[model samples]
Target: MSNRIYEAYVVHENDQGKYKGNIEKKRVDDLPKHGVLIRVFYSSLNYKDALSATGHKGITNSYPHIPGIDAAGVIEHSDDRRFKEGQNVIVTSFGLGENTPGGYGQYIRVPGDWLVPMPEGLTPFESMVIGTAGFTAALGVYKLRQNDVFPEDGPILVTGATGGVGSLAVAILGRLGYNITAATGKLQKKDYLMMLGARDVIHRDKVKGQSSKPLLQSRWAGVVDTVGGSILDTAIRQTKPNGAVTCCGNILGAELNTNIYPFILRGVSLIGLDSGRCLMPLRKRIWRLLANEWKPTMLEQIAQEVSLSELDGEIKKILRGDQAGRIVVNLNINAQS
Candidate 1:
């Protein structure tokens, strides 16, 4: 591979069983045998990357690992005919950061099918800024669109609105002219949410249903729920008839204390969005949407760039629920600045 010598953030399992991350030199040959070798120009942090970095066994089982779910760059080598060297591409999910060596490294060797050619309206940096978080957010918004939810239908509620997925969802929905009610735990960032196209910004607590009733006041023609658990449950119950809800996160908690009334009575559709497992055709479609008409208007406001050496602190911040927007890692940038 041409992008041979590089560096990566390696997570080590200490003798005491604690995990620590450090920057280390790495080689392209070290990556798993795959069809394409990419020199990643940029990668963006996601909640899953945080988990994998900290050695969450549920997200990653092995050690000496590099965790980054989103990568955008140029191909350095290709065993597959579909992709040629120097071709720009984007790869996210589909085990890139989980079971396989991922974009945290300056280079990634991945399967051919796990790739999507970089869309027309985006550069590598811009694509990483959109990353998996924005892609998933776009997927959720797409589901809302596919289900016939229109801006004129009613306001769309985005739970965890200050987060990566939530904020981007708000931006995309706002770009589409949807009236958005963003529910965030950090209300101090109300202005931030509003700037991202949210017409209304509410506290995350507002979505936590206070009663045991099967349903509540009908609102939200559709919902983009980033946090599962009670917030999602509350949202489903409160959705208007024939409304659709797309769920893409479980940071709040995975257990759902919900029933079927929201489904049978209101015809509320609960669409589970798993970006990693989505078929290629749909994955490419979503990326296209992100690069085109559905692209967020305030893209810069939704993302911040950081060097790889600064990643550890950001990982800690995200795990603490202190992150406000997407964190892009500029692979071309050096640690010493």
Candidate 2:
């Protein structure tokens, strides 16, 4: 065992009840006792990490905590036979970065069950680029495909097209030969969406449902919705007969005001994605696919790498909806573990 001190981003509550985040030194001994101790090489920033950083009680109840929902690294120590030293691994969700000391630190000790051997054809950086957001996007796409939604069906609509999950979903679906119509609030990012293989781009406002009508014109054969509220309702309403719409985020709002007409009239299936608690078997299958057949060609274009010190500003950018594509955190910069 090595006695090492590492840098980590920690959020703490002040005397005034306000929360703030900063980089601090942490000892390996401070990590939680678990079967595996990993030296995190890369971690990706997600909206949930932003919430946890700012003291969102729903995401994190404790302070002085490390917030990183997705991590990719090499095992440094292991008590379980399933994992050995120097093995590459990835961990996402499953109570990580929430109630647990997460990958924001250089070294994290986690239960062996939460670890997935980094799949073939993916490096630590690439895996973090396809972090929780990409995994969630893959899960959504998997659900749609399982329901028989294919490229030949018609154009698939992707909402929040420039965001992490939406961007990855667009890239993956595009790689699978799907005709994609991307929707985004940032009209300036139209070219960005096109580069991700969106055949068409539309303003998010164009899809926001204003009327109380349950069903709208059936235009989309499938929909990958990241924003909830009106956009989700509109997608559901506009899906063609026997189409599927998978929803994974509520960045817009949480409530669903639509009626049952979409489902009853068109047989549209509304699938809800919960990547955090996804079954281990399904999760591993999705990761394998992501590393193989479903891998996106433009991963470098879809992800921006940032150092740990640069994370605070990126967090603010995500919260303001100003961030386009994914932001990956490189924890190995000047790190020792």
Candidate 3:
């Protein structure tokens, strides 16, 4: 216990193209010297983590790196005046777990600007549960609202509704009094989506079947789309006049094949969501909303907690698209805890 070395899930790729990830002992001094050192207690898994762990150079260019994009803990040391020892904070996005060692480790040293004071009313576990995914969900809604879209306008469609971002979006929108329609390719998850407060759960195939006739039925006021490609195209075409659609992920496909008819004829807006580089002012505002009014009523139900030892199996499950909701990793747990 006197040793300062900590444990972390470090990833490595061999020259032969093989990849490996395991818990390795790391010393406190080994972490990069920077603004603040956080004794990370909890972190959450995301699609980007799966990509980085499996050697997706687009998401992570370096090897032997830790892969965790979201973390919540207390400050151990800080070179900046804004943070001090023992203060709880959460860090996400900002090149974390990408080129930089991420929350997969029990400790992280990052720039002062990268840390956000943990919002009031959220425990470390709760913050991790609402990590980057929750942040992105809130961002989608925030953008729509900024464009004057409101719950009274019309029903909002949330695609990829079974994923972390999508599930939380549904819950938040439902709590905000929006009529939410959850769309998922997994028919088996109908009840799960409904429990997240979605007014209705529909199969993805149904939406895909809608006619791509420039602009079709004017059905929605706003859209929170996590599945890109044809579903996004369809959502755009189906949205009502003056509606907005936030595109956040490429889970279905990166290519967005669509036309200008939705925009030209219906005056629809296609807003791109970038949770990673959102301005600090906006990031803080979004976090405040997540901790308060925009908080998802189903946050606990939509999150699963796991330890570092069990992450390997869970990571594989996530990569295969079998995981629903958020996966929070507890890094400081003792054997029994």
Top-scoring candidate (TM-score): 2
lDDT of 1 at 201: 91
What tens-digit string does per-residue lDDT give for candidate 3 at 1-337?
A: 2246888988899999978898888887778866798888999999899889889999999788899999899998889999999999989999999998899998889999998898897889988888999899999999999888998899999999999899889988988999999998787998888888888888988777477587778889999999898899999999999999999998788998899999988889999999999999999988988889988878788888888888888889988989999999999764321
TM-scores for all predictions: 0.97, 0.98, 0.97
lDDT of 3 at 309: 82
Listed per model in order, the count of residue pairs whose N, CA or C atoms clash below 3 Å is 0, 0, 0
**Residue pairs clashing, model 1:** none
Over 40-74, each residue of candidate 1 has an lDDT whose tens digit, in order, gives 88999998999999889989999989888889999
Tell me which residue pairs clash in candidate 2.
Answer: none
Which residue pairs show collisions in model 3?
none
Q: Which runs in model 3 stand beyond 4 Å of their true positions? A: 1-3, 334-337
Model 1 bad stretches (over 4 Å): 1-3, 335-337
* Residue 298 displacement in candidate 1 (angstroms): 1.2
The Cα RMSD in angstroms, rounded to one decimal, for candidate 1 relative to the true structure is 1.6
User: Which one is best on lDDT?
Assistant: 2
